[model samples]
Target: MNIDKNSVVTLHYEMYDANNQLIDKTEEPIAYLHGGYDGIFPLVEEALQGKAKGDVVEVTLTPDDAFGEQDPEMIRIEPLDVFPVEVEVGMMFEADDPETGDVIIYRITDVADGKAVVDGNHPLAGMRLRFKATVDDVRAATQEELAHGHVHGEHGHHH
Candidate 1:
């Protein structure tokens, strides 16, 4: 079957940045909800539509289609006391949203004598991405899988 909404797709993919540096890869199949939910990037889901098993595709997505453009507001400076004493540059910590209690990942970019600069933007937020993918299998998703809004099997549910 071709990949479509609610279809279960299994594929191996290599992801690269604009610099052509490898970011990630999957030797094992990566499965996800096709178009039923936004489990994967919309650009990728759109590209896989109507494609069947064994098809290979190369797709490129801009920042807007991927993680999105970097927002300057996501960068903040705070008192060093806000972080643990041992926090160092490049360390990541969760900063909770006071109202929603949602935890956002923030990376410590700079730590000076009495202040720290934390950035909440995703590492690849402003970069274009390239994906080289080979579709391995495509099948109708089970009702349970659809109910959960993700694909489940080898690598676990992809949310």
Candidate 2:
């Protein structure tokens, strides 16, 4: 079946960096609701439009199209006391942002000089991404899946 609105689209894909270095590859096919459910990247979903099983697609995404440009303002250095005990690099924590009234996840990037350096930007932000995928399947989404705005069951989310 061809990918269409409310369809469950599955793809076996690989991601690469601008330098041609392999970044990530799917070991199992990843499935997402097609036609603007926001489950997949806009650029990729656009490319997959009307695609059928066994079809191949290749696309490149800029910072804006992908994770977005890195925001330096999201970085903050706070006193060690602000964090939980035994803080270490690569740990993630959620902190309330007063400016936006939103909880932002911060990753501990450094711990030094009685301070913790945290960054809120996604790790892949500011990097160009290249993707290649083979369409594996496309089937009409069930009413429940449509209502939930995502795919459900078999390689997807469950109740």
Best by TM-score: 2
Question: Which TM-score value belongs to model 2?
Answer: 0.93
TM-score of 1: 0.89
The 10 consecutive residues of candidate 1 with the worst lDDT sum are 150-159
Model 2 clash pairs are: none
lDDT (Cα, tens digit) per residue for candidate 1, span 43-159: 788888999999988889899988899999889999977655777899998878787788989999998878888999999899999988899999898999988888787765744
In candidate 1, list every pair of residues with a backbone clash.
none
Tell me the tens digit of each residue's lDDT in model 2 across 52-150. 999999999999998999999999999999766878999998888999889988999999999989999988899999989899899999999999999
The CA root-mean-square deviation of candidate 2, after full C-alpha superposition on the true structure, stands at 1.3
